[model samples]
Target: MKRQVIRSTTLVETLAGVDRQSRFQHRRAFTLMETLAALAILGMVVSSLSASLHLYWKYRSVSRSQITIAQLQRGIIEDLTSDLRMTLQDPVAVRAASMVAAARSESATEKAGSEQFLNVTEQVLELPTDLRNQPVHFIGTSQAMALLHEQRNPRFDQARSSYQSAGLSHIVWWVNSEGSIRLPLFHSGPQLITVAVNASKDRRGLVRKARKDSGGSASSTSDEDEWLVAADVTSLRLRYFDGENWRTEWNSFQQQALPLAVEVCVTIEGGPEQETPVVIWLPQASD
Candidate 1:
């Protein structure tokens, strides 16, 4: 052997050899820069996916809120229209008779007045809502026992004497403490009560009372405000075709209270607080 000697190399040459052996040897090996770039791209993709998911959920919530509001409004409108059109017919059910008594009793009025309106979109109680326009058969409702203890009407009295033994229930559609707006069912025979509905900022489908006007005078003013609208009123407007025009205020309506076509407006609040104002045209006096 002719003077075999070990090769001596600098640190840079050693490192270059290692790099060539590790990366340059393979066609698919990633460089440091390429690895960092891939990581950054992956992060961006993940962030974009997260943002998209959040947006999707937000839109879904808004859509659900709107749907709920629509349902609530539709239900109220159906019940109101049925009562107005078929108020003349009396309920044939024995329990419904008791319902009428409970609906109009002083205690009932007080109870309705005392009770606060529902605020949430969800329902409090699991009360069943009736889709059919059947006559109210009971007046005691879910809180029949509690309401009976309060005794607004003589539903118990009527049932006690009769062998038929039908009972009574309250007729109300509202929300409960659990953030739910319950569309309570009522089978009461006919329109036994008058309600002024409105749409308010709080509830979407309903507009609360804003102003009071009088048709008695050209100025449109009110004094006693007997024809008054209350707060939390989603909508309570009257359509009196003055034989010439549609009037909303009661005073003005009284002045010309006969409409060939009566329009009823209403709103229902459930979720997302939708204020849907519907103008239902009804057959009014031709003259």
Candidate 2:
């Protein structure tokens, strides 16, 4: 009887222990519905965080691009303003002086002899309107502008005796579609400088070309002659302002005066289309 009672007690204790372990496991483990709910909540949180991070990076990229463009625009404006302000020769005065010189030459030829006078007069009368008219140093159009300006920093090369003095330089700004181009500001000597757009499959930017003469017949492999000003330019437009009104084109030869101001509009590509217009006043014109 005692052995049977002991065996029964042992069996009951073992069963109780098993039941307690099962209850503990059931309490500790999640239900199927609870697991699904927790998984959904976790996914939502992860997605929210991912979206926030993506937005942050996107905004940062756009902001950086905008800042870069803004700095470029500021630089362009400063350069334009400085160049325009330092114009050396007044177109009106230059044209007047040219006219006076021509008149004196004709008078002197007339005094030389009647036969020579007749021949010269006939030649002058038969000359084309373009040739007869005085050429103005300043020429501006909707897309391009050329002017004579004083060099800010003149450099004389001791090694190159042939280099001209940089007291006066000719500057031309235009827009064109070609290859990747960038031109640095060159003040080596009296040079005919041209600024234009260079466009390629990968990049588009402004290019500067400096030549020894206005004819651009001389070519050099020097990197200083050609370089880039800025990149990723979409468009460039130039406008002129007379004393009375704004004009899309200007010719000092025809108008006999310089524009009061010049407006430059540059459009950049990236993020959103950004266009900045900069106006530079001409002190020579005002004078």
Task: List TM-score per model, in order.
Answer: 0.39, 0.61
Worst 10 residues of 2 by lDDT: 215-224
RMSD of each: 20.8, 10.2
Give the local distance difference test score of model 1.
0.34
Worst 10 residues of 1 by lDDT: 141-150
lDDT of 1 at 87: 18
True-structure RMSD for candidate 1: 20.8
* lDDT of candidate 1 over 1-287, digit per residue (tens): 22333233455678888998877746455566688899999999999999999999999998987776566557656644542332112223223334334444644556564233222112222223542233222121121100101121221123222222122222222222123222212222232222222222343222111112232121222321011112223433344344566554222111212123345444333333434345544333222
lDDT of 2 by residue, 1-287 (tens): 99999999999999999999998888667576688899999999999999999999999998998899888777767766765665555544554546555666777766655565556556533424433212235667665566655453232122244444354444555444554333322221223233432333433365432323432222232112333456666567889998788898776545546778998987766625646567888875333
